[model samples]
Target: MALPTLISAAQLHEILEQNDLVILDSRFYLTDLQKGRQQYELGHIPGALFVDLHHQLAGDETEQTGRHPLPEPSELADTLMNLGIDSQTQVVVYDDMGGAMAARAWWMLVQQGIEVFVLDGGFPTWQRAGYAIEAGCNQATVAEQRLTISYPWLVSEDDVVANLETERFQLLDARAADRFQGENETMDPVAGHIPGAVNRPFMQNLNEHGLMKAPSLLLEEWTSLLQDIEKPIVYYCGSGVTACHNVLAMNYAGLEAKHVYVGSWSQWAKRILRKIDEANA
Candidate 1:
């Protein structure tokens, strides 16, 4: 059987030279956009290409759309191709921040039905294992491939708005507890979350060391969380970025996470702020 999409450091190191494998370094910081690239330039896993969250994985932000609006599937497919990913390629992505940022890349690819592996415990684990590291920019040979998008797994802002009245899906917030409670309002100017969304901070999926918890433990936690809720689960975060971490966690725990509010709290907050401004105007 094939390895799951969350591969460990040793597993990745063992298959580094496989012809069909492609490794990506996706380290990023929410406050400092350029920091990730600076770290990658210093050192990265051998043969790993760097991918920026905003520039590559996401599209330009508008006043209405969230901070990290997703790129079109075709655009992402082009990005993968440009990075030397072919149809037969096995892709693995990692970041220093555990799987938080890397999961964004995984979601974008997985939405298009492409299976992507996130480096379990991410770059820190690799470093701890004393794997080979290379510095500076590594050139990626362009690949001639047009990827097919056979699966779409997102709910639009309109859908979310409609759900408020219908209560068709369960809203799960992936922000920190304080942010969810309208207290630690740091990232976004608007405080609090969507009216009915429940809090499940993305970090809950990880242990004290910032590594993802075991699958069985995750299974227990997720099962208990979703125990009485019969509605389909929908995940969201400040900018629809870290929310993917929850999606990855749920899937890692063998739960089917088929929906994401791509625009997430960013878009929702933007909309609400616009309304408040209009009223004040």
Candidate 2:
């Protein structure tokens, strides 16, 4: 049987002893790049390798790219191979922040057609459940086989602009309502969202306990928002990290969006600003 997209702490505990599984501790802090590794060194799930959000999950950011651009396919494949992930490996990723960062890892693996799961409720739930923790890193024996990258998951900035002009697809922003509305201008230099995008914060996907809502509940929430909209939805967040959380939730609800704007708001805002500068000149 294949593992579901989301797995509970109990389910994870049962499979911890399994050799073919690859567990990733994806804890990250946007403000402090070193925080995730610090936390991992302090304590993490046993037999889990640390996957840095910046170092492994994201590629280099250019003037036109988002803060967390998708890593190069070859780079990511090498990283996965270093982690001993081959075609047969089952990966489970978790973080301290309600699977927000962890979902990025999950989405990347799934895009490559690898079977992966986000630990529901993340590391906190595991700690709460009295599961054992191991300090320092537990590196995997590097695998000789390379994983293939299908590269079909993300939509580019050009695709988003075309969609906006054509109005052929619905645009969903996974940032907070304030950020979506151009109120909080903390992360990105620009304050506003895509011209016609709708706001649905990724955090809403979780319940009071920080665990993902039931699939039925997720379906209800997403269905209400997308009721009158068309298929082939496009989703984005500030830097394309939290947006994956929304994508994961939608997949859990059996609703698949067509594309994820890998550059997201950061790239969009930059392009918009450049246009403004050119017009002013």
Candidate 3:
């Protein structure tokens, strides 16, 4: 299936009518913890379920795994069943900031082998387009949660280390240039990125208003970044969350769907020998 990383507002409006479609609102702010829930409480897309960054999207690995760590598959499967998602459902996810946070949930579902898509521009763009909003939460009864757990798409730390020797896949870092360069080390003690990750800030996927830029532009930028490689791409961020945004953008730009480094910087920080910052002074 040709899964477009983004679906237009008008297109989403049409998709909403499908009974088997599941919409997840992933609107979140890194600085403001309460704002995303507040926005969801105030109004959200009709029949959309909310996935909070701190609560549902990740597990309790704040100290070890940056901010968000991959949730246990059984636990995540339960959450999905509660949200009315099954293997057959077409899931749509969105957030306020381009798709940084939303892409986390998108990648999570994809890792679980679920076919999911991201709302290209996210909630703000939906609002800007004058889309109708509705209040109140939606709940569906679940008889039992049955998940066909699939986790083969991800690459392991050993895989990353081995790939570093051969450039098997392009390591894309979806973090700010400052963070990628090890200039700022506040988030994690050890600065610098994985051995050969090229920086591609998640924000580059969006416009000033938090909507995705044109596909042609995205293709051009990613093309420049991947010029030296002839392998599948892999992405990582502070945790595993924001990197999914870059994956979504690359997918939209007609790039291959890449692997996500779920443990990301947090895990890498724990092992200092793995810290290679030659790219930065």
The top-ranked prediction according to TM-score is: 2
Candidate 3 residue lDDT tens string, 92-174: 99887777888888877876667788886788778888999998777754525467555565665677768878878878888
What local lDDT score does residue 68 receive in model 1, on the 0 to 100 scale? 90
Tens-place lDDT per residue, model 2, 118-169, is 9999999999999999898786989879987656878898888888678887
lDDT of 1 by residue, 177-255 (tens): 9999999787777899998898899999999877899989999999998898999999899888788899899888888
Which one wins on lDDT? 2
lDDT of each: 0.86, 0.89, 0.78
Q: What's the C-alpha lDDT at position 122 in model 2? A: 92
Backbone-clash count (model 3): 0
RMSD to truth, every model: 1.8, 1.6, 3.9
TM-score of each: 0.95, 0.97, 0.87
Off by over 4 Å in 2: 1-3
Q: Model 3 — which ten-residue stretch has the worst lDDT? A: 272-281
